[model samples]
Target chain A: MIGVISYQTGNARSVLRALAAIGAPARLVASPDDCDDIDRFVLPGVGAADVTMKSLEEAGWPDYLRARVVEGGAPFLGVCVGLQVLLDHSAEGDVDGLGWLSGEVREFPSSELRVPQMGWNSVDVKSTHPLLAGVPSDSYFYFVNSYFATVGDDDLLATTEYGAPFAAVIGRDNIMATQFHVEKSGPAGLAVLTNFVNFGKAA
Target chain B: MLTTRLIACLDVVEGNVTKARRFEDNIVVGDVETVVAGLYQQQIDEVIFYDILASAQNRRIDLETVERVASRVFIPLTVGGGIKSLEDMHLVLDAGAEKISMDSMAVKNPELITQGANEFGRQCIVVSMQVKRVVPTAAIPSGYEVAINGARVFTGMDAVEWARKAEAMGAGEIVVNSIDQDGTHQGYDLTITKAITDAVRVPVIASGGAGTVAHIAAAVQEADVSAAIVSSILYSPRMEKLTTVAELKAELAHDYGIHVRPIVAA
Candidate 1:
């Protein structure tokens, strides 16, 4: 079964609904014990980075999730703040993130563009991966975040531009994440989640 | 590049979808669920569920309707009308709404905008203004003032100035509706829409007076708003030809050389 990690975030319901729409067996993972026997995991969040991290730590997610993704090499996906928390730090909450990926989350530098780049922007792929299968290049995805992740060139999967370029999608090894909300991104986004479900299930 | 959005505003009363002209002459179109599903089938870009009587009647927003309609909608769904406090915003967002819009409440208590933004991110708060044209005054130099209580009371707040304040107060987006042009079917008030759109950095949505496909196209190209909130143009059966969001998107791409996401038939 697919496990969705929901630790006091708002997007969990929409994420699960999207999964159900695609006929995938998924359940919310709210505790350490809920992380057991998961074929793949989705960490869905729509809250601030600091608050999400605190909630995850309070629920013993920092330790449990690291073991699941890093040590076990399980296929994993993160959405919005879920993707932000994978970095080393975020300017939003002034809190340290899970640091599973090597980077910091910073605010967009362009004052001309509005903060919380709220709308649909086109995603331009930088490199290819199994998780990106069927996701059309230049396809628009809905985004509602102020900070964008900063990582090495090798980890960037796709980038989108508002006034400046920001990482829209990222992947490294078994870890996959998107800065946009795939749950609300319509058909194109549904295809991304379908690929994630079937990515490593071949094992 | 981000494309212009076509949003459908469903003014619901009791439990059915309805439409009003200049905030009066209410008429029911269909059940909220059925109308919303039909939009989803045709692939409207976004939707707003405004409880028409909730603010005037002084009652809580209808959460059951929000939950029911939201279940059938896949795109971003925003809820408005009678959202007086953070608790009301919570109820709507928890009911599967992506954003919560405040009309009269935002003017009466502007702090709600900051509070809502701080607690639930700025992107969750939408400030919708109903504007009416008037003489230029010190309070409103733009000659367009804000009206509340369904256009029953006019506040001497300039539409352009108020939009700037709403953005500073943490409104992620602004919806500027023209009272004079509402339900007229002539076209959108491009003057007021352009004034507000040019004055703010955030996305602006123009509402009121959409007669035909050309009107919507003009709002997007001339006014340069991020989106247009249309109602009667799509609902009124008296129009020469019925228009769907699918047809609108296709026509936009063909006429103006704009590209919107394609929607498939359900």
Candidate 2:
């Protein structure tokens, strides 16, 4: 079973539903025991970073996750703030992040575009990965974010342009993350979840 | 690029879509699933279900209908009507709605907007506004006024001003509709729409006056809105049985040079 991190971030339901729709039924992993035997992991987050990180800590996830996802080499997927918490820090809550990946989450550059950059925008693939397999290049994915991760090109999997090019999808090794909401995106989104789930199963 | 969205709205009354069918005779009973699913097949960008009388009748959003419609379609669903508190918001979001919009209740207690955003994130909270054209009074120098409680209570507040306030309250997007041009088929009130769209930093959707493919195009080009709500015109027989979301997208592309999601052919 896929271990979906349960917290106050409010994204678990959609992610859980998407997992089921893609035939990857998951269990809500609120404690360390929940993650011990799970084959893979899905970290879903929404709302503020500090709140999410606090929730994660309250559920005793940071240390457990470090061992399970990083050391154990289990496949993982992070959505929205789920993707943000992988960074070293964020301007939103002015708090530290999970630091799983080397990066900093910063607010989008103020421009003609709206702050949230909310809408269906195309993601240009930068590197080929299992999670992106079967998903057409430049296919539109739903986005609703005011800040995006500023990560090294080494970990960036895909990029989307709103005011400026920012990391739309990121992954290195068994850890994968997306700045957009996959469940709300429609068919293109389902294809993404399918690829991620299948890739983990194969591994 | 964030292409314009074409949204299909379902007007549900007294917790029953069937009951409202008499007044809105164009809508068929038990067609919530069929209509929304059919629209989904045509690749409609988003679907919104409005619990028409939930507020007036002192009830809540039709969660049963919302759940039924949501189950039949995969695209994003937004539900509005009588969303009086955070619990009501949770009820609909749990029912599979991606976003929850508030109008009357939002005006009644502005804190609801901030609270909803704080708990669910700004993306999940959409503040819907209805604007009426009025004389250029000093308070609302823009000449467009805000109306609450189904347009029965005019707040003397400017539409543009109210939109800014809602956005400040952490609303992610604004659905600014026209009361003057509503159902007039003369297209959205471009003056107010453009005013609000230009003033806000968030995405704004022009609602309540799309009568033709051209009108939808005008909403995009003139008001510079991110989306437009199409209802009455789509239900008319001229629209080929109200399954014209794809057709509207096609017409916008071929005639007006605006493109949306490619139609998912049935």
What is the C-alpha local distance difference test score of each model?
0.84, 0.80
The DockQ scores of all candidates, in the order shown, are: 0.50, 0.57
- What TM-score does chain B alone reach in each candidate, compared with the true chain B? 0.97, 0.92
Per-candidate TM-scores read 0.93, 0.92
Instruction: Give me candidate 2's TM-score against the actual structure.
Output: 0.92
Highest DockQ model number? 2
Q: State what share of the real interface contacts each candidate retains.
A: 0.32, 0.49
**For candidate 1, lDDT tens digit of each residue in A115-147?**
667777788888878878867778878888778
What clash pairs does model 2 have? none
* DockQ of model 1 vs. true complex: 0.50
TM-score of candidate 1 on Cα atoms, chains taken together: 0.93
